[model samples]
Target: MATIALPRPVPRYRSSSPIPTLTHSINLDGINTSAACPIPIPNKHLPVCPPGPAPSDKPDTPPASPPTKHLKLQPQSLLYPPTNYKKVTHNSSAVYLIDAAGVAAAVNHISQQPLPEAGQVFPWLHGLHPANHVQQAFFVARRKALRKTPECYRGVTIVKADGNLSCSRLKSAVTTDEFMQTAMAEFKDIDPREGFSVRNFQIQSAKTAMLSDIIVYGEDADEVLRVGSDIAKAQRSRRQGLKALGHEVPVYHTFVCTSHFEEFEEHHPEIVVLDTRGELTGNVLDFFHQERVEMATMTKASEIARNVWLGPTDDLSMSGPSPDDEPFDLFIECSDLGRANVPALKNIVRELDSGAETSQYVEFPSSGSIMPPSWPLTEADDIVESCKWIYNLANGIRPSEDEGEITDIEGDSPMSSPIETRTSRPRKILIYCTDGYTESSMLALAYYMYAHGVTVSEAWLQMHIDKRRNFFAYPSDVALLNSIAPSILSNSPALAHTAPQDVTQRIHDEPAWLALMDGSLPSRILDYMYLGNLGHANNPDLLRAMGIGQLLSVGETAAWTAADIAAWGDENVCVVQGVQDNGVDPLTNEFDRCLAFISMSPYPPSTPSTKLTPPPFRPRPPQWHINPSPLPRRRLAQRHNLHRRSNARAVPLLPTRILLRARAPPQRHHPAASALQLRAAEVGGDDAGEARGAGEEGVGMGRDCERDCGDE
Candidate 1:
């Protein structure tokens, strides 16, 4: 309620006289202000005196000495919490009062009457006076909030009183011109391309069990535009995200949290922030503590970051493929069957030295070195020993790998130093020995990776292209190399004792089977549409990618499920229709079942396949699988009619009935025609061929064959 200014220091002059002292009006709590007088500064020659309330001249009182040269006073409230200053009110009187009676009797007797009651303030009196009681304000400006128990505070800020601090949500966090200018400056460094058109941004929050897809609005325009995101199992997300991004013009910079953000990289401005373990600290906080306290709070702070832009100036422009690249693929021939290893390697070396694209070539176990065993045994560092040889062949640098002297290859031309660079590491590897499908495919995969800085999946794909046929990598071998890829790349000595964990995976799924089937039969054009069983045709995951629906597979007793049909569409994928076929087959005793499943039923199919454009090549499926064979031409004619009834764009119809291939006969022998006719047995072993010929001759002609063949 009041402000007081303290007097400043002034130089004193030597004098023979005493100087009058400064004083103040007295205000008190049960204190006599009349006796409270100022202590005067005395001459150095004056004798020291005993300290008392004040100097007394009355004869009734003994002569009093001066106060101490130094002044010291302590307030009662600082050492105690219950004694803090409080506002006075009529409801409750003061509990205690200050006693200024010591000053009343000694100083000039302005208040000779006994000091007022113990619970009330005394009236003010003029003269030098000391405060009977000291006080402090409820609000502190340049002082601590709570001095006694600082332990109650932690972070940089604390809320002592809860007041109405009103704030409403803003679409953008940044409003001031200063903030935008600084953001633009950062953006300029991030993306030099001008014309600041990008607007929206996506911030992906990691999902937890308790909460998912939770979005919080921020004031800054950049933050408000953000949408949270996903993990790598985002096949569905990628497709949906691609479609969503393409609808609007390029106006937003979306931040997706997924790893495979290849879909967003093409046209839109994309910012990807991968989550790291550094985001959270693994510490425990036991108590609340002030941040500025001597012990300092032990709480961990949150980590955050944003990527303004990621340009391609360094990835390809700075470091890329080259002819003299150091790491190159090496192929070690390990034949499954007995063969001359030395002679075979020598032959390969000769072919390479004659006219290879690069001079960085060396055959394992060089020209004169002895060859090792084919099968690696347990405990003898079997496959491991061979691995070291392969490692040396690839890096050309001895990185303190275990068994050092052995790390040095005893070859006629040991690759001591690798060439500076290599343009393509995977392509450089070509392993062959009698048959390419044996034990070497996986080994070739490992070498391919070392030669080409790529992952196991990439290596497999590269090897697949290299052979353009069957390339078998053992599940065990594949697991071994993949596990050690990091160690090999890091050049760690840990690889020496490392063995493959029981983590190898089998080669399953498409195309792998396609290659294995190709060795005997040369390539044949078969439609990607396959039949034979419902299981193959109705895979939801597979169908979704191809955009092929399951309308033909409908009926309550239908083999496919709703998921199967919806796979080609979104999860809510639906179609409406009504029809049922009751017509019976004239040729067979069965009813005509497929009539309701007509082409262009209910809804149109969204698949990209056209009736004119042939589907992808399916090679061929075997005999027992080709179903109700056409030995009798009558059945073949029926197949021709079924093909005509439906629109040809349907993929399910092409699989089982269409596949046709044979090896024993010069021309193909239809499956049904493979049965024998009994009459030709007397003609001896050649009689079997005659019987087959007779069966083929008995086939009936389909009324529609000529028309279908013409279109084909």
Candidate 2:
């Protein structure tokens, strides 16, 4: 890849263009002042600092004080040299001069250094060095000029070893020779026998061994070791008292034996063996000799020997009769055989080994006898019991009489014979409509019913205006009713009123019947219908049939007026009505049994009006009227007195006095009777005084008047 050069910034000077100097030889103190001369210094002449302590203790001198401040001035640009002023050089002693104008033109120059050879060590190819040779060369040159050591190296080759290669015996079929050759080439300097191996190779010092020192040029080394080990072991075995014929060998270990007959014939053409049966004695020899053996009489003696060594056959059928048909051969039985026969047994182990068959055998301790038996059937019974237990656990009870019944046990249910039984309650539905009034509120009401476990049909609305043209009335207009009523009726037939031909027809319709059905009505509007008759009002056989007892409409001119609702006998009913005015319609029949008398609200419809009249005020009696007749004057006067006493402190003095004179005082105030006496005296002469003095004044006066009249 081509290299990119970064531009250098030029330092400005006041005098005839200052010369460009190496960064280390800039003499910052000299050029920092306005009067300094402009002179270029070659890179080689740059002051170099050696590793040493400074010459100190000559004298203690303070730094010169800064000059007084002057007027601020704009900076001037230095004249930089042209781009072609200097040529690139690879020599360490090469020096280049630059003028002040050329200082700004100084950029990274491409190095002409030759590329490092493969596997060669280069100083630049150290830790985290650049991959490009040009970058490393530039870095080296700059470091040498500045008398600084490069922190990284680059452009070095790495050689990787194959010690870490993983080979699978099952998949890799390379011959031993091929595997060993590959391993030897990878670790040419280190002998495999010495166990010298490389792990996690890294270029610690590129100055000595560059990346080129690391190379992975060969195949897997593990395969080489495995093949070499097998071959060497075989050769050693043959040299150590093991007979070898050509590539084949007869080898025997304590527990196993092998003979490569073909290989022996190929390697040893003169070897001959008249009887391979001589290798074993007694029963072992008999075991091999009883086999159906084949022979090539015309073959070489070496071939015959090789065949006998590597391919000798044995008949295991004659070695012992079937254990099931006869007593096992005691001489060859593993349990009866003595320890001294272990070595001989090992040599003929393959002949005595059992064929593939599975059996469960038990041995008799006293007689050392063995017997095989079939698996038991109790496992199936245990599984059946487990299934029953699980069934009982899940159902909380076991089957009894084939039916479910509550048992005396704390949590168990006794089963009873299957019979028809009802497990759910009948659902009750309420259908309601308003002039498409407060749809959100109505939907919320439906949601509340659902939440409370009440089944409610969708509300049917009767609107009086087109909704599309009047967005404001869209929530409460008749057009919305037209659009949504069909869907509501289709979904909830029990709550729907069939089409009516006339007002009378609708009055007799099922919807009207549903409206009168037994349900909790909003208390504010319940006083117009009888609770007992609500459900059966439209039923022909019911007492209130023909819908006479039902409230047909909820208009302002409905059968029950707001005054009637307000005056209802039930306090719960009236209070609930008052609360419903604020949009709270609680579902409690405790309010009123008269379903039609409830008044949800008396507010006028929300249609836009050109002229709106203020609602008139409603007056309420100061006291409750238990009877139609007015209260007695004396009782009125007493109540008036009580009311006045309640506000005595609030009334003006003059008004209070007039009110006190207008009404008789209460009997409870007899002890403070001065004002009563004064009023009585004004009404009648000394009688008032006599009345005040004598408690029975009226009785004596009546007798005196009667006696005087008798004298006359």
Candidate 3:
């Protein structure tokens, strides 16, 4: 259970007597804190921070929201480098160390370790930092990132033991989730909604060294060290017994933030007390943005704020700034004040993001569609290191000093000179489609088509059970995937042998209810603008569906005029010269009159107006611009070649967003031409008066689409 279960009602205290009576309470155990000092103590004799406030202690005053300023956002191009962040201010460097040998009993026994001379140190990997706030921040981010991939099993902590046959015995494969509820039952309780999936896990056996007992519920790192020391002692004692029997210890320390926050309220930043720390802080600072994000979200985490013990000296320390402080700024006095607000101040350094300023970085989309921001990376190399870090610790194996060191890096940004980069495998088990309405269904069809050796019809039939929506794909996407299907299927012997010829023929011969076909198909159009190559100028179905009984095809031979005949014509496919890129942009020159006619009144069969009396002009939904270049499939193909055994074949649709013309604001055509201009600059594009052109009716006012283009 999560520790946050809302507060017991705020107490109403009377001041009748000289002394006030106490009512409100928490359950923090009292600790002896006489050893704290302003001077830096050696890592070997570190001060102990408590876990949280006591039951009877008063709750800290809640802080107010921060002041916000409106900022404009510019369009960002895809397939480019990640947004470059301004350099972050470095204040205090905090460190967390896990005693592998577990020898530390008191702060006096805990010797601080220096940074490795080589390779990278992923801070989120070990969860062994001295700074309580910093470590917790990384932990929170890790939880967020992991939740994005519930289906992926790479990091799941599995305690696999069924009454074991080893030196140490077991009962079952208890997940970290189960273990936490059972083991830490007394310390913290989590609500299911606030709870996170289990990333770190352990196996339980009768002989498994119990480190849980050593962890004092309210005591901090010193207690952790004492627990580690006891575990080390147990491992040493069982060395011969385990070595002769050929078994490694199953008990190991995996992190769980069971402790509450208020334990370390007075914590503050001091100097880097350890010598020759090397690039210790360097690896951490490399992923500096992640740290900034975690800290930023802390401001909104009122539940954690009111209950959890945090250092008083650092940003994580609970804050009660004066009202004069920026409205939402919690720790106003921290040196890295601006840095802590990095999440909120994204527009300060304009970068390409989905929802830069408007979003608060938390969303649980349906069917788990959204991906987590990177931190606890799933890259093959990172996973290898993470597995090594967690498992080897359990097995009493220590990595050599030079083991996981990182070799490549530059300042701030990690990219380097034009080295050929290998693209990663597909993102997950489902194909991604841009149109949200049909993405889930499309993914289902795609999975069956590619993996099951089924014909398009069969695949559609398999997927049309509950989610039976028309799945649309660009003609090119289908062709590309179809071209590669044979090769992939041939390699899968079982699939190849089971694939039937007549059954496959029936699919094409019979036309599936959910077939994957060209966009020209009548069933494919989600709306008028998205008519991929599904229809031509004379297709009645297309004209009828769009309610535009007429199509004023530009650059084709037909009449061109803005009369009622043109504006309200049914079954009318008229051609006009100078329509740009197949009538995509009606706002451009020449076709303005025809576009105006269409905008003025409803098309045929729906209040079919015989005369063109212009009503209010309403532009279509905001134009969704997509990068047609390098195509999604092509990009994925280049990233990695598909093979028989590769399961990471599911590719997400390339992202698309509103570009040149956004939806018209109320009583206004668009935000301002400036918005479009800024978008153009980001993409190195030219709108040719596009932003102002569509919304402005001055040119096409009262013009008739009555005449033919050839005649004109």
Q: Give me the overall lDDT of model 2.
A: 0.20
- TM agreement with the true structure for every prediction: 0.21, 0.11, 0.19
| Top-scoring candidate (lDDT) | 3
The per-residue C-alpha lDDT of model 1 at residue 253 equals: 14
Which one wins by lDDT: 1 or 3?
A: 3
Q: lDDT of each model, Cα atoms only?
A: 0.23, 0.20, 0.24
| lDDT string, candidate 3, 399-489, tens digits | 3434422233231333323323222111101122221112122223333443344544444323321122223223332343344344333
Tens digits of lDDT, candidate 1, 1-712: 0111222346778889887555654456535566666555458967776787554555645676766422222211111221422322211212111112211111122112233221111011100012212111211211233112111111101000111112221111111121112222111112112221111121101101001111112223222222111111121233355457552211111111111222212221111111121111112121111111101111001000010000000112112344443322333334333222333333333334335654222223211111223223241232333433443322232323223312222344433333233211111232332222222344444444443434455444333222222232322344455455553333322222223331122112222222221111111111222111122222233232222333222111223454443343221221111211211112121113222122122223333211121211222222111111111121111111211211111122221111111111111111011011000000000001211111111111121111010011
- The full ranking of all candidates by TM-score, starting with the best, is 1, 3, 2
Task: Name model 3 segments beyond 4 Å from true.
Answer: 1-445, 448-477, 480-502, 510-550, 557-570, 578-712
C-alpha lDDT of residue 353 in model 2: 24
**True-vs-predicted CA distance for residue 185, candidate 3, Å:** 70
Model 1 CA lDDT for position 597: 23
